[model samples]
Target: MSINIINRSGHPLPAYQTAHAAGMDVYAHLPAEPVTLGPLQRALIPTGLFLEIPEGYEAQVRPRSGLAYRHGIGIVNSPGTIDADYRGELKVLLVNLSDTDFVVQDGERIAQLVVARHERVAWQAAEELSETQRGAGGYGSTGTK
Candidate 1:
């Protein structure tokens, strides 16, 4: 399926792909700029674009594995969710985990956006829920390797 993307700036940005087997496409900026992120600092990086996702689907903002493993820079919210009903600009929230400064150059692939389906839940008020063998077992109660 094809997804429609709107470039608010009225310019075309480069779509990048690191390898042939990659699932998501990396989108670049039309007029790119350098972004400096300090140690343990966070910044909201704009893609200079907006999207019109189909109903019943959502977009997930994630980090690039190469950047996260090599430079220790990753998205704070690992898989940031963008609801289908939202009609706003898409921005990436990145955090620098390295000790030194990290630079984000213009037209660089900083993050990845994956379109996914979300399951809706219907809430109901009830006195009790179904019990299980490990009911209310706090963190790490199962076991450890």
Candidate 2:
């Protein structure tokens, strides 16, 4: 499926791709220097682009595994939900967990976007409902190991 991308700035932005695949597209800023994240620091990094997501679908923002494994830098909200009705700029919230500083280049592939389906449930008031064997048992109640 093709998603519409809008580069609000005059410069060009890169595209998205899977890690196993080479030549994945990435968007970058023109004159701004790369972003550096200090230990225990958090920042909202802008994507320099906007999206026009189609209705009945949502875009999820996720982190790049390489960045997380190598630099201890990852998106605070893994698989962040971007509602279909949201028409604002696409930004990423990154957090640095390592002791050293992490740098984010202008064109770096900081995150990935996945489009998926969502459901909206209707609210109802009921005194009782059907029962199951695991009813009301949560957390580790099922089993261990």
Candidate 3:
């Protein structure tokens, strides 16, 4: 699927890293000096990108697995949603979960963007939902056997 995008970060456009990658790696548009995030700190990292997503579609901003595993860096809102009508710059909410500081360099691959199609559901208010064997079972209801 083709998308309309505007790049003002002076960096290359976001692109898929591999032949069959689902998400396109997004770059961080920061200054020459890096932005340091202390332990438990969070910041908004911009990408200088503006996207015109098609109707019934959205852009999912997700965290980089490598950064999360190596530096404890992750997105504040894992899989942040960008609606089709949005016409602003793409920014990532990054948080440092490790004990040390992590520097965010310019043009760094901080996040991945997956453009997807979604459906709008119509609400059919009813009395209650159907029953199941494990009905109303909250988290961990099914044990790890």
> Cα lDDT of all candidates, in order?
0.76, 0.74, 0.94
Residue pairs clashing in model 3 are none
- Specify the poorest-scoring 10-residue window by lDDT in model 2: 22-31
In order of listing, the candidates' clash counts read 0, 3, 0
**Candidate 1: which stretches are off by over 4 Å?**
8-23, 28-32
Q: Give candidate 2 regions above 4 Å deviation.
A: 8-30
The collision pairs in model 2 are: 14-26, 14-27, 15-25
Model 2, 1-145: lDDT tens digits are: 6768888655455444556642233343424777789999988887777877788788888777788899997788887878877878888888999999988776677776777778778989999989998899889988954
Across residues 1-145, which tens digit of lDDT does each residue of candidate 1 receive?
6777777544344244555533464443535567889999988877777777888888888888889999988999978888877778778888999999998765667787777877888999999989998898889978854
- Stretches off by above 4 angstroms in model 3 are none
Better of 1 and 2 by TM-score: 1
Q: Which RMSD values do the candidates have, in order?
A: 3.0, 3.3, 1.2
| Best of the two (1, 3) by TM-score | 3
TM-score of 3: 0.95
